[model samples]
Target: RKDALFEPPVSTFQPTMRLANVSGINIIPGEDTFCMDCRILPCYTLDEVLSAVEQCCAQIEEEYGVEVCYEIPQKSESPATPKDSPVVKKLSSAIYRAHGIQARTIGIGGGTVGAELRREGIDCAVWSTLDECAHMPDEYCIIENIVKDAETLVEFFSE
Candidate 1:
C-alpha cells in the first residue's frame, strides 16, 4: 500500500521491449532484449542499488542460461530540500495562499530539472496538481489544473 508520505520511499523498474520481426503470433522471440528504467529512491546510492541489480541479473542469467545486458544512460541524485529554507518558506506561503491549504515538503525519486538546480546550490519548489501521469504512457495535462497552477505561480511570483 502507498501512503501520501511515500514513507520508506519507493523504487520502480519499467522494462520496454521492441520486436521488429515476429513471424508467428504464438511464437516467442528468439532473444529477449529490453531496457530497464529504474527510478531508485533517494535513500539508496546508485552503486549500492546497481550492484544489487547486477547480482539479480546474474542469477537470472544462470537460471535461464541466457545473457542479459543493461546500461544506465543517465542518472542523478539530489540532496533533500530543507523544509525551513528560505525558498521553501516562500513557496509554502504562496501555495497556502493560492490553494487555501497548508503546504508540505516531501521527497520523490522522479528526475526533474530541479535536480540540476539543487546541485548548483539553487533551491526550487517542483510541484504539480493532481494527474500524476508524468513520464508514463498516454500522459496528458488537465486544463483545469493548468489554470489553478497558474494562480499558484502568480502568487509565488508576486511575492
Candidate 2:
C-alpha cells in the first residue's frame, strides 16, 4: 500500500513541452500521502479553461460513467482584481456558456505563496486547468494538460 501510494506507475504521459516548475507538499509522511502542487503561472485563458472543463466532464461521463458538476469561485471568495483580470473574466464567461452556471471571481482573504511572492517583488498569478484533484487517493495529472500548461507557461514567461 505504501509503495503503491508513493510510486505510481509511469504513465504513457507525453507532453509537448517541459514543465517550468513542479512542487509538492508531504502532509502525512508516514501515511505515504502527499499533495501535488505546481507553479504554472501565466498560461491560461478563459476560453481554454471552459473548453477543458467541458472536455473533462465528457470524459468523466464516458469513462467513469458519472455526472460531473463544476463550481466556480464566488465573487466574495476570489481576489479583488480577479474580475478585472482578463483570465478571470474569460473563465466566468466560459463557465456560464458551457454549463449554464453563473461563475464569478472575487478575493480570497488568505495567505499563500502568491502573496509572499508579491511581497518579494515577484509578479505571479494562479490558475488551474483541471478540476481540483491535488490530494486524492489516486491523484494523477492529465498528460495533455501538462503539455497545454507548459505551452501556457512559455507564453507567460515571454511577456
Q: Could you say which candidate leads in TM-score?
A: 1
Q: After superposition, which runs of candidate 2 have C-alpha atoms over 4 Å from their true positions?
A: 1-112, 121-123
Across residues 1-159, which tens digit of lDDT does each residue of candidate 1 receive? 233444435667777655465678898777755576676665567888889988998999999998888767787876667668888888888899999979878766667788888878887778678687877899999899998889889999999
- Candidate 2 per-residue lDDT over residues 1-159, each given as its tens digit: 111211232111122233333355634332222222221122233455468658977997899766666544321111123345665555555555544556534333334555566556544455445656775687888887776556555554444
The C-alpha lDDT values of all candidates are 0.77, 0.45
Worst 10 residues of 1 by lDDT: 1-10
- Model 2 clash pairs are 78-106, 78-107, 78-108, 79-106, 79-107
All models, RMSD in angstroms: 3.5, 20.0
C-alpha positional error of residue 48 in candidate 2 after TM-score superposition, expressed in Å: 39
Q: Give model 1's clash tally.
A: 0
Models 1 onward score TM values of: 0.74, 0.31
